[model samples]
Target chain A: MTTAGINIHTGKAMPLNQANVDTDQIIPKQFLTAVTKSGYGKHLFHDWRYLDQHEQVPNPDFVFNKTEHQGASVLLTRENFGCGSSREHAPWSLDDYGFKVVIGTSFADIFYGNCINNQLLPVQLTSSQMDQLFALVESDASAQITVNLQDQTVKVKDLNFGFEIAEQHKTNLLKGLDAIGQTLELDDKITAFENNLPQWQKA
Target chain B: MATTLYDKIWQAHIIDAKKTSETGEEGLIYIDRHLIHEVTTPQAFAGLDEKGRKVRCPERTFATMDHSISTRSLALDACGPTNKLQLQTLADNCKKHGIELFPVGHQKQGIVHVMGPELGLIQPGMTVVCGDSHTATHGAFGALAFGIGTSQVEHVFATQTLKQSKAKSMQVQVNGSLPIGITAKDIILAIIGKIGHAGATGYVIEYSGEAISALSMEERMTVCNMSIEAGAKAGLIAPDQTTFDYLEGREYAPKGDNWTQAVAYWNSLKSDKDATFDTVIQLNAADITPQVTWGTNPGQVIGVNQPVPSPNDFSDPIDKDSANKALKYMDLAPGQKLSELSVNNVFIGSCTNGRIEDMRAAAAIAKHGKVAPGVTAIVVPGSVSVKAQAEAEQLDKIFIEAGFEWRLPGCSMCLGMNDDILTQGDRCASTSNRNFEGRQGRGSRTHLVSPAMAAAAALAGHFADVRDYQ
Candidate 1:
């Protein structure tokens, strides 16, 4: 079984309310040169958060620079998160940057799959549910919620909401199985099919 | 259940069901219409040579030079070092193997995805395979088209088939009326946003519904072109009057009585009214807006008025962290509106959004306004005919007067295969797919958007909504 990282138990949810969070914004194109996924975290928003070339720096008004949510782990966004190009690096950067769970009204199809496959939990909440979570985050910056993969429930205070996950995908994520590993789980069936092919062709 | 387009096309191309060599697995399905290009063909061809095998059916295979040829109108001889060898090699390989090759300067030379349908090689009721993901563009013609790797390319060359598993079918029906300014680009972007980019993976998307049916053949093609971006095998709208009209009297299309027979069969290449799909997604056409990519991938996008998402707004640490990172690279405030963002250059071309219609759309905007100062802008058509048509209508002159460079077509700045590229620290609003860092060139920043949006951005010298101008 895959061991859980830092649990993003949050009853408080701040809604980004924006649509279409593209991959380039998640991990800027500048950081894609490295062969490995290492060291990309530092540069993830280098230009966005700070101005290195200019004498003036740190636009304190930026959401990432705000004090209330500094070091906040869980992220909640509006509809259509991760919509743009299909660079696998987008998810890789997200996984490496200490995000354990992402709750949104919806996500771009490829990014959602990549996030799920890479062991990052991307929860699709109803728009109303997202609004509620946003309200919680706005009221209490330190609000805590529980996302229990075992129960497939997202807990916020007295409310526990069910989230659907494909059975196979759930199993693979819990077990830290990549596509190859998951494909290997059906090895026996594959072998059986192979064995039957040539003989069946003759028939 | 009634037969779907998927059922009809898949049935027509099934050559054999044979067991695998390694495990004698259940017989895998074979395919026809194998397509190759410079990006993935060299190694496969080399592998074949090493194995001492001749191309099994060179006639069935076709090659083209788009990924590595200069789109500059200055002639093919002037192509830079990077593409010269690859371009030459494509011609040499096609000559040696007796496969049809569309080298630079040939009327057929264009994006492999564009040329396939234009040449009628990708027809109804056939299985088409290419080494590029965008090959799914061919599926618009009722063909089963998808991308494959080099090894798979070699397999098709050797045996004209591939080992494959069937995919579940998904139908995305978009009904209702599209707004006047809305184009196929907007429809696709809106779909990706609605369904998420990977929503269609492991499935072929059959686009139906009222809006799709009303679209022109070219419009349908624009929608199918990006099916791969959504992680689908392909996308298609059922062939109809538009298809018949476009194919009539074309070079490769069937003629006279043969055309009648073909149309009769083509009419049958649709999902039956009562047919079912594994999943059905219904969308309203009026809800979509012109889309733009703010991040590296096609899925990371926003409407013209939306603000960039900030990480603090997320409950998941990864999403927060990733958003923070994206905000950094894009050099924008997460909470800031997209309209306020500035653009350095505007590029209107590529397999995704480059076409005669695309050029015309950009020209429509350019005709009314001059490109904003300091905004470097260009409009590269998809083919020679497209360029000629643009010139015939004086679209090129209109673009030129508006300070947009009009150039020959060859995947310019789409994937940086040739000399067309963005310099370090240059930010461009592009009409191409993919904004992977340096995808256009080293240290280049690309924001993907619709052609109309690109034109608007050029006029504003920044990211702005076309609706404002409209």
Candidate 2:
């Protein structure tokens, strides 16, 4: 479990609406060397959100920089959001930037796992459903959406959509259980399995 | 049950099958091998220390420094203070945990994916993983390998097990023999070009067919390395005689009776004759041409003879918009021939195309000519072993004599993590994967191609057909 874990959240929805938004764009390689995961939110979408190399001036055109969508806790985008790199820092930046849920038509596998690990919900909806959410956010920048982990539902006004998440991920997110601690309980099982392994299977 | 090779391997790794667990469906799958690099493992080691947990299986774990290390030289101080800290942290962490580390200057040290296979640390019918998207490179041996985030890395360090949801199976069948000059890099780029980058988002692709079967082991590794570019966590080819041959004399491969047992097990790892896949994509090798990326993403590509694509050329609106954004970032005009444009830089290396075979292919082209004036070219081999082998064969002389810089091994100019960066507005023909905006460096425009193609471009100072040079 984490002190920063979330179960239910409702806030303004920001529409990126682009497909295949990769990790390099999410957080550029230059900022990956920090000793810890925090302090990355400022650099989230660093290349796209900044007008200059120093990142001092925010690009006014980016959705996240727009005054109306400034504290959005939900990100609504098109297909294959977070498509490259196994960088958990991508989700770390998203969580640090106050985003509780990433709504997409589809998501890259490793990126999805990272989001679950960090308690940043990755909510997958159909293409049309994603279109609807994009339309909702585009029409009213202040539009708020609610994500309920227990129900596995993402609701924007009256339009409600169901999403699928691994049962294990859901339980961990809801209970704030740390994955490593939980696995440590299986030490005996691992030992037993190792004892019966073939020669080539062991180092 | 009609089980695929993927199913067989995935099922074999299951330590526990949990049907009702809140954590995962496949339950706990044992990790047979773990490869680590400096960039992602520092946090994982710290996480272990935070929890006061030792590495559950240090013997199965391996560490290396690549991502942030200096490729300019072997000395630790050559890396800037920041990179030095990251490298030192990994070495210190590995020592504390009793894990083996191939540090800088280690004769076998190189890129994680490159060193792993060349050393025979990876094998067929195993579950391999690393905190890198290119861990799929190991899947070329028919291992069920995939990338994991640092949290998963920490979890693996603590338990040597992962709770995973099995991926759907996909078979990409490449039919007929590859035409001359069409390398595995071109085939994979062509595959991603046909199926958009997100085409296989939720599946683990098992490549099969005449074209796939015909590829060398290193070529197969090149293809599987870019599985992440296709948005799949892993892609694999079955282990055949070719795989066995590649592993026969490697440092870590089994010996004598153990080898016999291993080969027998690997043979059974293939899919049954009538097995079915969740999805199938078909491509004929004859139709594929030398591919060149016209836009930022790997999927936004065209054949060598084709013109740079306009946004209007794309049928999907998302693709159209993405094309517009890419063209603008790359500062290229649509409808213009890519071959007519000049490149200021050419880089031939990365996990995708940094092996001995890749070196030979590029060296063949470089030996015949000099690097074009005003163009800067560099050859960064994938690992120390690969570099030594290339040097032994005098391929380094060919590159250096052709005016291309002969750099040491690391992921130089691939992600631009080190000082090997592209200056602003530089256009480069790079053998590395990913052509994302600023991927090479700020304001850098990258054209992805095979090593032969990159070498040809270096000779011509422009995007030239490798077939023409050969």
Which pairs clash in model 2?
Answer: A1-A176, A1-A177, A1-A178, A168-B22, A168-B23
Query: Model 1, residue A100: what's the lDDT?
Result: 68
lDDT of candidate 1 over A1-203, digit per residue (tens): 12343233443343355545655556654343332434555554444555552315775755666778766666787766775544445655655655568888777555665575557788887877777777777777777777877678888776677887655446656666434333334446544543453321211
| TM-score of every model versus the real structure | 0.70, 0.97
User: Residue B36 of candidate 2: its Cα lDDT?
Assistant: 94
What is the number of backbone collisions in each predicted candidate, taken in the order shown? 54, 5
TM-score of 1: 0.70
lDDT of 2 by residue, B280-398 (tens): 99999999999888789998888989999888888888888898899998898988998898999999999999999999999999998999999999999999999999999999999
RMSD of each: 9.6, 1.8
Flag regions of model 2 displaced more than 4 Å: A1-5, B19-25
DockQ of each: 0.06, 0.75
lDDT of 1 by residue, B352-453 (tens): 766778888888888778999898998888877677888999998899899998887777787665667787778899888776555676567888788888
TM-score of chain B of 2: 0.98
- Residue B105 of model 1 has an lDDT of 79
